[model samples]
Target: MRDPDLTQIDPSRHLLIAGPTASGKSALALAVARAQGGLVVNADALQVWSCWRVLTARPTTADEAMAPHALYGHVAPGRSYSVGDWLREVQELTGRRLIVVGGTGLYLTALTRGLARIPPTPPDLRAAADARLRQEGGLEGMVRDLDDATRARIDLQNPARVQRAWEVLQATGRGIADWQAETPPPLMAPDDCQRVLITTDRDWLADRIAMRFRAMLDWGALDEVRAMLPVWDPQAQWAKAIGAPELVEHLQGRLTLPEATERAIISSRQYAKSQRIWFRGRMKDWHLWRAGNAGVHPLPES
Candidate 1:
C-alpha cells in the first residue's frame, strides 16, 4: 500500500522537505524533484553562501546536473542573508511545482506561516547595541533589561537573536515580539503545500552526522575554510556556520585537527537536537517520515 503520508501530498502542489542536518533531506528532495519534474529551491541558510560548499554539505555537482536547483551558494560570504532576504528572493522565482528543502526552521516558517515586517535597525542603534554587547560581554542582561517578554521568549544562548531583539527595541522603541505581531501573509498557505518532516532515531542520526563530517573533511572542507580565512569576519552570518568557527580555531593553531573535528561534530549534534526541538514545537503537524525509508522508495503515483 502507498504510504499514508505520501498519499496525502498532492504532487501538483509545492513540496517542503525539512529535517535536522545530515538526515538525508537533500536526497529525498532530489528524488521528489526528479520524479515530479519540479524545481528544487534551497531553504537552508548556510547553503546559500558561495563559499564552504563541502562544509555546508550543499548539493553536489552531479546532483545539480540531474535537476534544476535554485538558491544554492548564491550569496557572497561577506554578506549577511536573513530569512526576510531569502523570502524576498523566493518570491521572485516562478515555478509550477517547487520542492523546497532545508533544515532552517525560520525559513520554512516564513514560507508557510509568514514573517514579521520589522524595519531595518538604524545604524546608530545597531552600533549602540554592539557596544553594549561588547561592554556587557553577553546579550542576556541587555535583552532582559530592554524587553523582558522578548528575553523570555527568545533563546538567550543565541546572542544573535538576543542582540536582534535588543536592537529592535532600541531602534523602533518596540520589542521584537511586538513587531512580530504585525506579520505579513505567508507566501504559501499551509493547506496549499505538501509538507514533510524527516526524522530518525537519535543514535542513527548521530552516526550519520559523524560520518558526514568525516566525509566533509576528506572532501577538502579545511581547504575551503583556509581560502576564506583572509576575508572571514566573525560578525558575518556565514562565518557563524557550524564548521567555520571550529575550523578557524584550528587554522589559528588554537585547536588541532582532531580537536576541531570533534568540536564540530559535537556542535552539529547539538544543533540537530535544537532543530528537532523546534520541529516538534512548531511543525508538529507536518507529515513525518523516517529517514532512509522515504528517500529510497518511490511513492506510488497518484
Candidate 2:
C-alpha cells in the first residue's frame, strides 16, 4: 500500500521491510516502529559506517528521535564488516520487537535465509584479491576465477561478493555455493515474520533518487567527503557508499560539483536497479506493495 496501515501490523511479530534505495522503505519501517513500538534496526550495509550518513541515506537525527534505531553509522571508516559480523551483532538486538529495514538485499536475505558459515579468507588471499581489484580496476580476475557454481550463484557485479566467493573457493577448496548448500537454520525464518517488499515504477524511483542525492548535497554530503579526503581509500569498504567516490573526485578537483552530482545520481539509480532485481529474485514470497490503490499482498497479521 502507498501508506501502509500500521495499525494492522501485529505487535508480536517482527517486520522485515525490503526494497530499493529511496523507495520509501525506511518511512514505512518508521511508521511500523512508531505504531507497534518496535526498534528500527538497520540492515543496509552502507549505513553502518560512521564515515557516511548523508551520502548513504542513513536515518536523520529527527528520524531516530521518532523511534529507536540501532546499527546505523556504528562502524569505523576502514573496518571490514560482513554479513556474518552483522548477524552476530543482530543477536544482541532480538530481545525486543524489531522493525529491521534496509535496501541491502544480501543482509535482509541472510536474516531470513541462513547464511553460509564460510571460513574467513586468509589475510594474504584477501590482500591479493584487493590488490588485483586495484590493479585491474574491476572484478574481472576474481569473477573469472570463481568456480562455475559460485559464478552462477553470487552477484557478478558486486566486487565484494565476487571477491568473497573467489576467496572461499581458493582458501577452502570449495565453492561458496557448496558451502551455502550446507547452511544451518536461519536466525529469523520468513514464516516467523511479517515481510514486506516495496515496489515503485522505475521512472518514479529514478526521479526520487536524483532529487534525494541533490538533497543529500544540500545536507552537507560534500562536507562529509571533505572530512575524509585526508585518509580516503577508494578500496575501503566504507568508501563504497554510492556517492562517496564521485564526491571524492569532486574534492580532488577531478570533477566539478555538477559532474560529481550527476555521476552520483547515475550510480544510485544503477544500484537501485540492482536492488530491485535482487528482491524480486530472492524475496519472491514477501508481500509486494506497489503503492496506490494496488495495495499489498496480505499476510498473516500475527
Candidate 3:
C-alpha cells in the first residue's frame, strides 16, 4: 500500500502538537493557526487556570490576539477540570481547523479516545479515601482494587487518584476500572484528523529551555507567584504548577534568584523528558517531523 499523503492534512479540521515544557509546541500551533485560519485550543493542564499566566506559561494577550485562541487561562484556580470536559468543548467548537496543543498526555489520550463517564466523587467520599490512602499504602491498594486500564492511566502518586477510585466504587458499586472499561467513541475519527509530534534534538532543546527559564524570571515569574500566594492552596492544581515549588523556595529565602532559575530549568528539562516519552510511546503512530526540518521552524515550548 502507498503511504498516506501528508500534504492532504486539513488545516481546518484537526492537528495536534505536543511535547515538554519549552519545546516550542505552542509556537508551531500558532503558526499553523495563522496560516490556516484555525483556532488554537489549549490542551495543557495548568494553562486552564485563570490565575496562572506567567507561572503556567500561558500565552500573552498579544500572542492570543495574533490568532484565535480558546480554552487557555479560563478556568478558576481552585476548581477541578477534567479531560472529558475539554473533550466536550472541543466537540462543540465551530472552527474549521482545530489545533490542539499541550503537554498533558492524559488530555491528549482522552481527546483521541473518549473518557469514561465516571462522575465526580463527593467531598465525604473523597475524605474517606484520603483516610484510606493515608492508613494503607496508596497505589498498591488502588492497584489491587482497580482494573488494569484505570490503574495505568491514574496518576498513582496523586492522592486525588485514590479518592476518585474509591468514590467511583461507592457511587456506582463498581471498581473504577470497570467503569472505565467501556471504550468511548473517539472525539475525532481517524480519517478526519491529523496528528503531528515536533521532535527536537535533546541538547538544542535543553539550551533553549535554559534560556526560556531566565526569560520567565526576568518577566517577573516570582512576583506573579507572590501575588498568587495570598490565595495559594498548595494542594490546588494551579498551586502545584511546575514553577511553583521553585518560586515558593525563592519566597522563603531558601534559594536565591540564580538558584531558583537553575532549579526551574532542571525541572523543565525533566518535564520535557516525560513529554518526549509520552509522544514516543503513545503517539508513535502519528506523523512526526523535527522542528527546523524542511517545513518546520525551531518551535518554542509553550
Candidate 4:
C-alpha cells in the first residue's frame, strides 16, 4: 500500500505510530514531530519507567532536546503503572500536536478505544489473587473459574493480565468482559488522528532485535540494570522488562554475560513477533509502512 501523505495531515490532530520493537517506529515518529513541530508522547509501557532509559531504548537527550517529549521515564521503578495510569497521564497533556509512539498494544488500544471503568482492585483482593496464582501453578484455572469469556480473550500465558481479571472478579463480582462493556469514550476519536503501523519481515526484525540488545550492552544497559537491582522486586512490573531479568540473573551469578545476552535476544524476538501479530490483527485500517522505507518522511507541499 502507498504511504499516507503525512505532510498533508492537519497539525491539530495527533499521530499514532505503533509497531514491533526495533521496527524504526520511533525514528518515523521523530521525523514526523520535527516536520510538524509536534510533541513526542510515549506510548511504550517500559519507556515510562524512570530507572532504565538506556535499557528501554528511550529517546536520547539530544532527541528530546529537538522536540517536546512527554511521559517518558516519568514513573519511578517498582511502582505499579497500568494502562489506566498511562491513559490518565496522556489525557492530561494539553496543546501542541502529538506523535504518540510505542510497542505497547494495550496503551494504543486504550487511546483509540476507551478504557473500561472497572474499579480499582482492592489491595487485599490483589494479594489474595496473587497468592492463588502462585498456589494454582498458573492463572489459567483462576481465570477459567472466574470468567470463561475473559479466559478466552486474555493471553493465558500472561500472569499479570489473568491475575488482573481475577482481581476484578473478586473485587467487583463482575467479569472483566462485563466491565469492558462500560468503557468510556476514547480520548482521541479515530477520525481525528493519523495512525500508522510499521511492518518488517520477521527475519529482519529478529536481526534488528539481536543487534539492538548487543548495542544496548555497549551503551551501558548492564550498568543501568545494576543500578536498578537495589530496588528490583521480582513481582514488580519493571523487573519483568525484556533485558532486566536476564541481566539480573547475570549479575546474581546465575548466568554468564553471553548466556544473558542470548536469552535476552530470544525473548525480544518472541515479543516482537507477538507485537507484529497484534498490530496486524488490531490495526488493520492503519497505514502500514515497511521498515527502512523513505516514504515515511513528510514532503514539502508544492
Candidate 5:
C-alpha cells in the first residue's frame, strides 16, 4: 500500500500511529513530528526497557537526533513497568502536541479509552498468582475461574492477561472488567486526536519481520543479549522482547544460531499477527491506512 500523506493533517491535533511490528510506525511518526511539531512519545510496552534497542526495534540514535523523543529505553530491566505506569507518564505530557506511536494495543486503549484506576496488586498476591500460573496446570486452569465480565474483556489465550485477571479477582473480590467500567475520562479522547492504523498484508509483513530480525543481528542484537545473560531473568517484563529469549537461548548453547534465528522470526510474525488482530478489533474508528500496499490517499481536510 502507498504511504499515507500524514503531514497534511491538522498540526494542532495529536497524532496516534499504531500498527503491527515492522510496519513503519516509527518512520511515519518521525515524518509527522518533523512536519508537525510534537513530542514523539513511546507507547510500545517493550520499547521502554533500557536493555533492548535492536531486538525491540527502538528508534535509532540518529532517528532521535532528528526529533524530540520521549519514554524510549528509559526503564531498567529490573523496574516493574505496567500500563498504569505508562498511563501516568503520558498523563504528564498531555499539554504538548504529541505524536504517540506503537503496536501495543493496551497502551493506546488506556490513553484513548481511559484506564481503570485499579489499585496495585499486593506483592504476595502477585507472587501467588505467578506461582499458580506456573504450577497449577498453567494459565488455562486459572482462566476457568475469571468472572464472565473479565473473560469477555481480556484475551484469555494470553497467560499474562489471564494471570492479571485472576490476581484482580482474587485480591479485590471484583473483576478487572468492573474496574474498567468505572474508568474516568481519558487523557486523549479519540474525537480530539487524529489516529492512524497502518494495516499490512500478511505475506508482506511476514517478509519484513524476517528481514528486520536479520537486521537486528547485523546491528549487534546478539552482543546486546550476551551482555544481558549475567543478569537475565526470563520472567522480567524487559525479557519479553520478541527475539530476546531466542537469542539468549542461542547464547546459552540451547539452540544453534540458525535455529534461534528461525524461531525468533517465527515469533515476530506471530506477534505481528496478534497486533494486527488487536488493532483491527479496538481501532474501528481510527483512520485505516493500508500500509506496505499501494494506493494510499490523502484525507479531506477538516
Candidate 6:
C-alpha cells in the first residue's frame, strides 16, 4: 500500500517527518536515519535552545546515542536562531541522506521553499524597538502597525516576535514581508525530497499533549526553566518555551506546582492545535499519516 506521494521523493537524499507535538517524530526519524544511514536534523524551534531539554521535549541523551543528530540543543538560550540559519545549516550538511523531524512549520517551510534573507537587525535598532514596544502599549501596537502579510505569519501575541519585526524594519527601512517576497534561496527543492505530515486524531493528540506535559514536569521541567531565569528573559525565545510562562508563574509563587503543571498541559494542547492547523494550511501537499496506523512505513527495517 504505497502512499502516492512516497514515490515522489528522492529516497536517497531526503525525508521529512512532521506531526503535532508528542507524535513520536523523534523516534520515527531516528529509525529512518539508522536504517538508511541518514542524518536526523532538528526542525523544531525549542529543540534548538541549549537549556530547554525537559521543557521542550527534546530527544534524550540516549536518543542521540541511537543515531547521528544535528542542530539539536546547539543554540545558547535567549539567542534567536532564524529559519535562514537553519537553512544554511541544512545546506552545509548537503549530500547526506537527511531526515528532518519537527513540529515547527516555519522551519519546514524554509527547508522546502526557501526563506527570505532578511539580515540581522542592528543592536541599537533592536533596543529602540524594544523601548518603543514598552512605550507604545505593547505587542498589540506592533501588530497593528505591521503590514498585514508580516502580521499574518508572525505570532502576534509573542512580544519578541513583534519587537523583532519592528527592529528589522527600523534597520533595513523595509518591511519584512517585502524582503520575503524577494526570496533568498531554496533550502531544499520540492522535487528533491519527500515531506510527510504525521496527522493524529484531534482528541488523541490532545491526550498525548496533556500526558507529555505532565511527564515533562515530572522530569524536572520547572528546575530547567528556573535555572535559566538568571540569564533568560520571560520574552526571550528560550524563556517563551512551551511550558515556560506557566513555570515562571510557579516560580514566582503565583501558581502552585500542580496548578502550573495543569496550565502547561492546557497550553501544550492549544499549541498542538495550532501546529495541526498550520500544517494543513501550509503543507497541504505533504503525505499524511495517522498516529496509530501501522501500515505507514516504520523505519530501521528489521
Candidate that scores best on lDDT: 5
TM-score of each: 0.92, 0.91, 0.86, 0.92, 0.93, 0.87
| Per-residue alpha-carbon lDDT of candidate 3 for residues 177-231, written as tens digits (9 for 90 to 100) | 7877785788776666777776778998898888777777777778888988778
**TM value for model 4:** 0.92
Task: Say which prediction, candidate 2 or candidate 5, comes out ahead on TM-score.
Answer: 5
Segments of candidate 5 deviating more than 4 angstroms: 1-4, 292-302
lDDT of each: 0.83, 0.83, 0.75, 0.80, 0.84, 0.76
Give candidate 6's error at residue 64 in angstroms: 1.1
Weakest ten-residue segment in model 4 by summed lDDT:
293-302
Better of 1 and 5 by lDDT: 5
Q: What is the Cα-based lDDT of residue 56 in candidate 5?
A: 89
Evaluation by lDDT, superior candidate among 4 and 6 = 4
Give stretches of model 4 more than 4 Å off.
Answer: 1-12, 136-138, 294-302
Candidate 1 lDDT score relative to the true structure: 0.83
Q: Among all windows of ten consecutive residues in candidate 1, which has the lowest summed lDDT?
A: 293-302
Candidate 2 residues lying further than 4 Å off, grouped into runs, are 1-4, 136-140, 291-302
Better candidate number, 1 or 5, judged by TM-score: 5
Please identify model 6 stretches exceeding 4 Å from their true place.
Answer: 1-10, 147-161, 294-302
Off by over 4 Å in 1: 1-9, 296-302
Candidate 1's error at 260, in angstroms? 0.9
Write the residue-wise lDDT of candidate 1 on 78-99 in tens digits. 5657899999988887456888
Name every residue pair that clashes in candidate 4: none
Please estimate how well model 5 matches the true structure, expressed as its whole-model Cα lDDT: 0.84
